[model samples]
Target: MKLTDDHLQTFVEQGFVIVEDFYPEERRAQIAEGIRQTLPPWEVIADDPPARRLLTDDFPYADMLFNEFILDWDLIAFVQRVLDTEDIFFRYAHNWARYPDPGAEQPGLHIDNGNNSLLPPTSDRRYGQISTWYFPEAVDENQAPMQIVPKPYGQDLSKRVLLTVPAGTIMIFNTHLWHSATVFKGREGQRYSATRIYGRAD
Candidate 1:
């Protein structure tokens, strides 16, 4: 799981890096299906703030995925190698759900974090936030992948960067940075992805 030198460079220059093989296809499918079972039916509030969920229960594969990603061998190594911190505080995360296209977009654009309170936004950096942008199914131009303003937390935010590497590859990114996944355009089946926020420690 440890990132190679190439991975480190990409993370620094771009402000984010995508690591593959975080979960095998078989495991990814199993975990995605299990998490979906815990979500409410996708038929309400599509016009409002959109429907979202908070994980209050203990599920099997969901927990398994959490363990495998949150401070997994590779994640831990990444934290130590990149941030030079022995440990990172992972702030509690809320589970999220998105239906097909034409839904709400309030939580749209902008990083996973905000700072209307902190004068200089210093408090916002206490915890490093991250999420595994899990794609239960295949993603394409139509499916809409997550748009990450790579390094937006500290660099230029003039334009956003987006990419579709592969399914099951965990996108470990800063929650304090601005990002949003595109909405699916199809009219039938829905795209499913759950973000489990991980707050890096100090």
Candidate 2:
């Protein structure tokens, strides 16, 4: 679906947008599979809980190790649309895989840097690199889904917190926002999500 001005406003004010089915289901499967192939068996799934990993590791530990999702024309089209640009490049990305497991607690609300415990930002910074995650599985509310605190430090931020829609839903959020995935029951199920970064052309 094309992004409307309202969508952009929501993102700027709330820090994220959950666009339903941004990609066709068939294509989403391919992207998900590509990410699955590169994962270690140990990191694959957890019936008791799920698994989480940052592909940015030095030695390297991402599922696909590349933008497999970018290759899909339809998917890229949507990405371009959301970005409101005629052209875009597929830069860096990360992946997350949550399996249907017991004792799964949703991820806590934290910014990207905060989630990873990166160096604190300077006071003048209003935004950071934008990141997007396309979840390919079905996510129900009870799953804890992904909760976000809109524009963490933005003027519009109300301290009003909210949860993102489940799997197969795509979310584009400002890195400055505090967000996290709340793990819930899905022991036998798998939640696969990937992020793609976009930037201006040189």
The clash numbers for all candidates, in the given order, read: 11, 14
Tens digit per residue, CA lDDT, model 1, 63-129 = 5654544446666567555555666554444344545664434346765444211123232333455
How far does residue 28 in candidate 1 sit from its true spot (Å)? Answer: 1.6
Q: 81, model 1: CA deviation in Å?
A: 2.3
What's the alpha carbon RMSD for model 2? 5.6
lDDT of each prediction vs. the true structure?
A: 0.55, 0.55
lDDT against true structure, model 2 = 0.55
Model 2: per-residue lDDT, tens digit, 133-156?
777666665444666666555433
TM-scores for the candidates: 0.68, 0.63
Q: Stretches of candidate 1 above 4 Å error?
A: 40-71, 103-108, 115-128, 152-158, 163-165
